[model samples]
Target: MSEAPWWRGAVTYQIYPRSFMDTDGDGVGDLPGIIDRLDYVASLGVDAIWISPFFRSPMADFGYDIADYREVDPLFGNNDDFDHLLAKAHSLGLKVMIDQVLSHTSVEHAWFRQSRESRDNPKADWYVWADAREDGTPPNNWLSLFGGCAWQWEPRRGQYYLHNFLTSQPDLNYHNPDVRRAVLDEVKFWLDKGVDGLRLDAINFCFHDQQLRDNPPKPEDKRVGRGFSPDNPYAFQYHYYNNTRPENIAFLEDLRALMDQYHQVAAIGEISSEDSLATTAEYTRDGRLHMGYSFELLTDDFSAAYIRSTVQNLEAQMLEGWPCWAISNHDVARVLTRWGNGDASPQLANLLSAMVCSLRGSVCVYQGEELGLTEAEVPFEALQDPYGITFWPTFKGRDGCRTPMPWNNGINAGFSVGEPWLPVPAEHRALAVSLQESEPGSALHRFRAFMAWRRTQPALRLGDIRFLDTPEPVLAFTRRHGDETVLAAFNLSAQPVELPLDGIAGATPVNGHGLAQGTFADGRLSLPGHGALYARID
Candidate 1:
């Protein structure tokens, strides 16, 4: 237990602060609210918690538009509250990892302000600003993820500033060394506050083509959502110049060097690239990021083949680098609702949890996942996400899955005394923490038990996966480590299936959840519908 690397086989829970909980009846979750629930978070058996931004912002994109790097937003409390939360989390034996949005900052940030003002200030080159063409058009043909042109004209500076997302979050000019040093100093500010690690937001987008070259148009059919909208034209471009530049590698090396100064301090980058697989491998290779995760499993597709191919591709390319796997997060829909048929079963939830834990890389479990909570419906008027508002009907955006966490059956699910910023789903109340605490077989209890059990299986934790040839609705794999082997089989369909086990080997089920049991004889193992089995093979 003491021998594993800090990140390998670790389970991290992501907390979207605004919806997690709220103290002081402010309707928005704050640092104090998180501190109050430190014990409850630790009881879930997660190794660490990745809290989304609580820095000062204009709330245009919630806290993602960071206005100030050092000060805590008054909406979320001050620096003292953050320090208190850190101490409380560490006291409960839980690690704290803050989200760092180095790629961009709020247009209102002091650096952006100084950069936009007069253009001769010391911070003039801090943000990506370039002169417009003679016709007053943008400098280049780059589109913003929030729709329209990625560059916005600043009348005072007589230039266009680049914004990958909202115009409020202007992209930083990473080509400038002064900007890099300033960003690192902000990183040091959090490290000095005793955070164990950092979750680098949109890490690859930190640097772009300094020449401002036009991104070649990609075929409409060849687009995928690396992070932004897949259906939008933003995805229709190759994005060769906007992100994942060669300049990012040296900055990553500098970042790694800084983290190496502390014991067990790690950094995981959120890689959103047109060539995400190649970039994920490169960003994590050697001494770059400690790990990087892409949108491989966070899509609408859900099949045994897709899952197998994604993992196999990473295994072939990543080699020595580490990967982090996540099915649902703040930006994506809940897997049960997005991938599963509308009527999601508790059995499938248990199966998905087991599957993610069995993967070779680390895992991130979003809040309310333990309850097997599916996506909730938020009325158009109640939708706070700008992305959803802009692309209504066709794509409702991420608000459905970003609802308030259910803590009790009481009003507002006990997330706050006042009305929560996001509405709590009526269906989620029955699966509240208070109700699940009393039920022995509840998903919440099963999550804790299964996580504890997973810690004991070294084959599942650090072993290589060998996919077995199997029929539809059946996913089989063997995790092997130096003569020790474990066979994991899943009946993906709603009907029974029999798996043939060839060669000389013995097996026994490592029961966690009360999944179906099968008897094996003459190299054949019989399984029932919605069944799964993990066996110690000898």
Candidate 2:
């Protein structure tokens, strides 16, 4: 275990820079602010920090719509600030990873600007431009993930450009050798900056079917299980042609080749497609990427069986590829509320953290999760996400999760002196970092204590997981590595439960982990509500 790569089983803390902290009081968090909070991030005892996009952008989809890959947006300070942040994070023993949105770029990007100018410009065909059908409709029936057709008309070019997301974010044509070369060079710009890793955003969307074939209609019953809701038109189709094309394999190899040149640099791609699990397996196989995470674990399924099946499915397919799991992120509602089931508690939060971390893979823990922050309620009047504005009451986009972080109980939860980009809910203020830090029994303290303790257990970190058969609301597994075997079990509900360890070998309860402890005696295991048990098999 000591010889394993630093990222093999690391717990990465995902920091949403726009909501992390606002040092300049511009109502948005900046790189300098992240740098200032590096100490606090270090205190969490995480192995790495994955900062969401800070690249220059027009804020069309926040920083996802990048106008320039090489420049840091003035809203987030210049390259100097990022350099300082990186240096400080390294000094604090935190590996730094930045979001790399390669599949698309903002409409304002110079390449897109020139490409949209005319059909034969120097940068023409830099993006996915297709002629409209005879009826003047979009070339195909493909739908944008942000609603409406994926194509946007350009009067200057007399053609439509593809945007898998918002209209302002144009998809790059990876088929174009020049475009691929340019994007690779842009990525190299970061590698040159000494970044330890890259969190690839929508990496599977890099290529579209060259023929632009229409996607097949999906069965209504199958639509909701994926990341999108039933209300989203995007879930109506199987989405075969628009993304996760065969061509992406080669490009990922090229990316991996470039990364191989650097020392211990890693890449973890975010994948969403028709079969995200299969694609996650393929993308991480054969040295394509260091690790890959799909939206499978990020969904609203809180059932113990679902979690077991999801991990087992991937484990069966991803023989050679490493996997990364996340329960929450800048996108989607926070896992606490999504999985809380009406009655949630600090004990439940601690159990959830332990459960996800104990899974057989590296983990990404979202910011404010240490304090067990639930989803915020951002009103329509204060909403900034265009996706939410487009899909009102039914689907509230990701603003609830992207609201400014609560650092303290002071005004605006100490996120900023100015009005926050999204209003912080009064509920979040009560669980602010400062308040949690003062109370040793708080979620924050337990999380830190667990993380610190987790480091001492090598089997929990890199051990191979074998799930044991148990009834609902109880998840039991054994982690085996080297000559050591550790048994872990969790109660996934707010009510007490008892299960028999029938035919199981003797186990001595391993204490020191900060969750509610369970009892193991006479081959019977008793767990309190939201309780977890860890034992070393004798």
Candidate 3:
């Protein structure tokens, strides 16, 4: 048997630390809470767990704005708590991948603090700083992903610093060799502590256009940001100068060289750019990132053609690099609610899980996804996400998806004794883990069954995929590896569909998996609403 790396075709469960579980009665989940639920995570039969940021931060952008790379935030826990979580996860045969935000740091970060104090400081060039224009305007027309201008003025230095997301988070200058070395050293600290891998946050934004050129205005017809609403002005430009710079490739190469020293450690980058698919291909190619995932699949477009086109486009561009697929994550709304037209059904959730896993790459399943959780309704009063608050009513932001995970149908959904950071939706409580555990046909049970069975199928685990021509709402693909060929198909709509199975001969049905099994007869396959099938082609 070939010794493939552990991350290849692996399934990673994403745990948003703030909403996963809370044990300290502080209304916020912590490292100890994660450790307490290691058994529950392991029970899902996932290959790994990718924890979102828990590093020392001011919580400006929740944990994205890092105040210190080496220290754990008191809100999450201390370093010892992290060590214990890592050890416990490993003991359960689960690889642990922590989120690493390398592009920017919280303004409260010591490096940023010193850099902003004066121009001649030792760390003055550590961050991207520039003088204002002669007219006293920002250095360029760059816009922050959150809102307004990307430049934040610092009176102490009499200059403006670039902030792609929030003013509290200043973008670092990779042009400075010292900055690169320092960030790499911080990453090395985690590797030394035996982290299995890293899920690099905003990896493409590490290096900005040094010339401070203004980004060209995007055509009105092309104003759609990947994951943002059209109302946000950030989508009005091409974003060429602010992010996705060509210089980022070299830094990735340097980071990859450092990781190569460690045994079996991997890096997966999160790419969000004007052309994220192309950027994903570039970052993962040539010994940079082991894997790359974009927001292509996470968008609200839930059509068979869109999914096929996105995967095929990436496959064509990603020459020798691997791809990771995720339907939902911390930044986006829950897939069921987003794609189901407001109907969150067990069938839709189960079908999505199977469909994404059957694709030609590794996969990530967000927490609460197993229980068919929909997007929680966070009213304006309860809103905590700045992104949503900034664009209220028009775009409610990510807090709905980041609400506390429902463990039981009790007060606070058994997430915490005290109030949660975000309110748990009553609808989520209806589909709690406790309630689903007892029901054999629940989404949670079906998810576990499908994942367990997926591990046994080598073709699905690691195989070449070829999409078969099918009509609307029906997707068909075949996976083949070493004389083993498996055919998988799904109906991505609410109505039943009939598909003609051409070129498929003598296929043996695979059973006992809790998917909505479709029937094949007389060269015609009949699939019910949200139906799916997996078979071995003899």
TM-score of each: 0.97, 0.99, 0.99
- Superposed model 2: Cα runs more than 4 Å off: 225-229
Off by over 4 Å in 1: 226-231, 502-504, 513-519
Global fold similarity of model 2 (TM-score)? 0.99
The Cα local distance difference test for each model comes to 0.85, 0.92, 0.92
For model 1, residues 17-113, the per-residue Cα lDDT tens digits are 8988899898898888888777888988888999999999998898899999898999999999999899888888888899999999998888888
Q: For model 2, which pairs clash?
A: none
Model 1 / residue 458 / CA error / Å: 1.8
Give one digit per residue, the lDDT tens place, for model 3 in 1-538: 1478999999999999999999999999999999999999999999999999999998989999999999999999999999999999999999999999999999999999999999999999999999999999999999999989999999999999999999999999999999999999999999999999999999999999989999999999998865586688999999999899889999999999999999999999999999999999999887899999889988889899999999999989988899999999999989998899967789999999999999999999999999998888899999999999998888998999999999999989999999999998789999999999999899998999999999888888889899988888999999998999998989998788997889887677787668889877677878889998788887
Q: Which of the two candidates, 1 or 3, achieves a greater lDDT against the reference?
A: 3
Report clashes for each candidate as comma-separated counts.
Answer: 0, 0, 0
Ordered list by lDDT, greatest first: 3, 2, 1
